[model samples]
Target: MILTRRAMLIGATTTLAGCDRIGSNARFREALFSAENFHKWAQRSLMTRDAMAREFRPDQISPIFRANGTANPNTPEYKALWRGDFADWRLRVDGLVTRPLSLSLAQLHSLPHREQITRHDCVEGWSAIGQWRGVPLKTILDGAGLRSQARYIVFHCADRMGTGRPYYESIDLTDAFHPQTLLAFALNDRPLSVANGAPLRLRVERQLGYKQAKYLMRIEAVQHLSGIGAGKGGYWEDHANYDWYAGI
Candidate 1:
């Protein structure tokens, strides 16, 4: 039987609840991590490296794309940028790159862009199809000139979680260079609203919604995930035990 994305997410959620009840069980945690690794391996092995995520026609786009996670970061720094219409905001690209970059919003807009109407499957079991327009992430990576040691792309965002941790996420180079992966600045033919990650957000189409880090302030290339927040890759992955490889 084929399991839909929603079904898979629901099953994962149920399993996570069970794991929470057994939180102190080291063996159980190890088993869960092993299972997640296996799932990622199976998906990658079964599909071509550049396999494209399903995209929809413009008419199929959702009438209302509900914003996930924080609507607005509301930090003084973010608010200052918002007030200036993000003209002063810059996306820093460094860490394991031959040449670091500090790209302004206008500079990003000047780059070649791609637009796709794709479905966003959220772990919370809600999905929305929206048209996203932005520079392909590969374009940015190529410009930055990755050092040979770089294996992952880390997104640093402006939003702070309830625990006062900055929101962040990572993806392997495979996803980073995927044709559909983008540093999206516009959604549905308009500049992204603050609630929808204005100025910049990531569109790793093949992954779950949480992997699409929003309010992006920097992109860092790293050799290992160990030095990141709590060493689990992302805020949710570290604090809430969400699987790091949340591939759909």
Candidate 2:
């Protein structure tokens, strides 16, 4: 049944993969230009979020859950901190803010925390229910003081994609404060595995897997995405056709 559902989702995504060529129909391009229209169309054709994605009962937990992304960053800077158990790994919260913060792992955990058993829905069609513990991003943002012009929050990571200098991602303020959003440090009641973004990672629950960026090193509030690395929202969004608005 899972495989059948998976096939259907792929078939649907393929159907929407329209092309843009010289002399492309003006009407077709116009319709897609309004991203809001594309968003509605995509949601209609893809798998909607299932209730299984909610906080799961302990009995429903999965053992041997798969981890995603770089298990450990290869940078000597990261390795040296790992040897020290990340006591000095500070998360720089800068960009358009009144008072930027330099947060340590211990300082992050000192803030108010929330725990939720959310389902991780990968664009590849796998799903897992796991509990995550972290501080609300709003509390962190408010404490840092956002400028009125700051429209989005970008997460700079310590990992790289392909030959790219480093991997980075961002989201607008609305999604940043969504009740399900968190800067998670623990997964399934234990310190998160390095593969799953040890120390800290983002859990923006309403989006797809890749949007849940890992290896968080800095947080920057910005007005527009135009100046950030190729002016694209993320690596997958830039290289692959992963939609920027990946709301489920």
Candidate 3:
């Protein structure tokens, strides 16, 4: 009874349509939120903090790793960086950190790197296995000297959604420090292309594809997500009612 994302979404749509009729019921809304929280709690309780997501062999990599979401930011600023081959681009790490950092692409490349071939399960019902290579996110966080008050790591991207809102996503400290959580710069041994989030992207392997924020411009350590877009922790979470914790 393993349901695919498409199947689950289909079932959820039907159920939600019914719920909409009673959407004004406070009890029902509370129950829905409670269920989402329970799902997250259950998963975290069952898995250890250091648990690793399943990885595949090089031979299992997808022949064509389809790029999801904004293919290219194509904005004036992003375009300028692209034109310069991203030499001037810097990933700013600030917010609730004792030592803020502005890391260049070259600096990131010089850090210790991790490579993994893992399946990216998109909520759109598509999955692709790709080999990602980059520095683990914990490495950057440590360098920034994350403040004790910080509870979540937010990724600010260069792309914007249809509504012109800047794309962003956030993860709790648990996932932020996970061994497989990487700020990936290369894929399949090649530097990422514009369509595939060149300068940098996130690889929170335990979560769905959308959690992998691309075109990362800034990484902010925040005490809470209340000030972020719609306060839902991500662009899709705010716009599409996507669960904040999209663990697979």
Candidate 4:
């Protein structure tokens, strides 16, 4: 049964009597582990468990889409690189791995890739359809050679809040290896615009837009996001009360 925010908020007779209460409590615990500092443990339990985010047809692609999140991170490091057309950018893959990888966009693009048109639904209740082209996440993970204990895939990005660095987000192994989860380097059949995550982004089609983190800088194989930063698994999950597992 799905325990929506509506149902959880009302503390309906059924809600008060069951696991949502526990979930709420758990969410509180996960907040301190987050970098942006928000609570969301209960949010996951409130939603439908094991749900899927929406997908779409190729022709459903939107014509005039607005990119979400920071248009450009205001750091000298990012600026210098971006000004250079990200020629020095590399996607770092490390943590709980056999061999760490620091791969350039050219290197990543050389791998097998896929293109799919899918709908991106934001939490604020807007949606757009676009075609994404990139390597499937599984391909990268296979190359990374995840250790037996690695249970989550975390994305470290390049935008900031206040004085904090750009935040990171993560997902469990199930979603990480999903065939539809692509490291999107192109959107709408063209290279992703700066406002749209630039060089690369995540496309975990089974989850909400936030899970599809933009301006991706690194990918790490890990057993938990817990000790990483407050541990709730995402930026908004830590600061804004959004569920880390916003599945559909």
Model 2: per-residue Cα lDDT over 1-248, one tens digit each: 36687898887766655443522677765566467556746764574433123567877776755787567777888788777888989999999999999999999989999998878888888887788999878888999999999999999998887665677788888678667789999999998777898778998887788888888899999999888876777777667646677774
Worst 10 residues of 2 by lDDT: 44-53
TM-score of each: 0.91, 0.81, 0.91, 0.78
- lDDT against the true structure, per candidate, is 0.94, 0.80, 0.94, 0.80
lDDT of 1 by residue, 17-73 (tens): 987888768887787668889989999999999999999998899999999898899
- Candidate 4 matches the true fold with a TM-score of 0.78
Clashing pairs in 1: none
- Poorly placed runs, candidate 4 (over 4 Å): 1-55
* Count of steric clashes across candidates, in order: 0, 0, 0, 14
Better of 1 and 2 by TM-score: 1
Candidate 3 per-residue lDDT, tens place, 1-248, comes to 89999999999998998878777688876677677788899999999998999999989999999998999898999999999999989999999999999999999999999999999999888999999999999999999999999999999999998899999999999999999999999999999988888989999999999999999999999999999989999999899878888884
